[model samples]
Target: MIHHAGLIAAFMDGGWRGALIQGPSGAGKSDLALRCLDSGFALVADDRVELWTSGGRLYGRAPETLAGRIEVRGIDVLPAPALAWARVSLCVRAGTPERIPEPAFTDDFGLRLPLLTLALLESSAPAKLSRALRHLGERR
Candidate 1:
């Protein structure tokens, strides 16, 4: 299925795991993604993501037309380094995040992805996501 989401992949354990960013327009999804990229994550898809299920896990990628491209709100659509696809490990919803929220999950293709709410524009958002991914890795 195609979704209005942005996908960014973080390198971990010699592989890439995607974080699916979802929110309404102007919710800073792309902005968050750019920050993630600047922080060493790879772009999978920006603005729209194609999702599928395989081996009990959800995976995401960019559509052919949008591959290797990301839209920067104030700037032109720019080319970026991207992966063909990635196993999704997390879902981030742009919003007013709780200071210490309960654990949450979001279902996609019957697979539940660990969920985190973040104020995407905050300078610390990318670091928070990196920490969350590390915590999730520790738990597994």
Candidate 2:
């Protein structure tokens, strides 16, 4: 299924793990993704993501027309280095995250992914996400 979301992939363990960012328009999905990119993450998809199950794992990618392009609001849609696809390891919802969030997960194609609610525009968001991914890796 294709969703209105931005996908960014962080290289880990010799491969890429995707973080699917979901939110309403102008909710900082793209902005957060841009920050993630600045922090060494790769863009998997922008604006729209095509998700599917392969060998029981959920994966996602950009649609053909939008591949390698990221929208910078009030700026041009610029080209960037991107991955063809990534195995989704986390799901981030743009919102006011709880100070101490309990364990949460979201299901896609019957696969469950760790969920993190974030205030996307925060200066520390990308760092928080990186830390969360590291914690997630430790648990797996």
Candidate 3:
């Protein structure tokens, strides 16, 4: 397993795919993830995610002790709907998002996933992520 310093959340439309949210401490990784979960995505891991590659695809899972738990800032750690694992399709970096971000990708266990950069505190962050995933799906 590959240890990661970020949050992993999954969304299922016809199938499941995850987004690896990475950034510095207090960069709103968990906040954006919670927004995604609120928008119907499932939690794979929070704060720390364990990644692995299988059949050329990268997948993410929560460490045993952290499964089904998410720490909301200023609130106690809360139990949330979670997935044991998910195939990751994207990596969202929590930073300054461009009006049209230059194409980017992130590597996990030798597998590459599309990267979308965004400012997590923006009110439209969740909607923007959803849109990006949908656009990615159309290209697949």
Question: TM-scores for all candidates?
Answer: 0.95, 0.95, 0.89
Give the TM-score comparing model 2 with the true structure, all chains together. Answer: 0.95
| Prediction 3 TM-score vs. true | 0.89
By lDDT, the better pick of 1 and 3 is: 1
Q: Which lDDT tens digits does candidate 3 get at residues 1-140?
A: 65655555545467877777878888888888888788877788998888878888887888999999998999988998788988778788888877776787766458667888889878798888878776764544
List the candidates ranked by lDDT, beginning with the highest: 2, 1, 3
Winning model by lDDT: 2
Clashing pairs in 2: none
Poorly placed runs, candidate 1 (over 4 Å): 137-140
Count of backbone clashes, every candidate in sequence? 0, 0, 0
Worst 10 residues of 3 by lDDT: 3-12
**Of 2 and 3, the candidate ranking higher by lDDT:** 2
Tens digits of per-residue lDDT for model 1 on 74-94? Answer: 889999999999988888889
RMSD of 2: 1.1
lDDT tens digits, residue span 1-140, model 2 = 99999999888878887888999999999999999999999999999999998886888999999999999999989998999999888889999989998988887558777888999999999999988877764554
Q: Where does model 2 exceed 4 Å of error? A: none
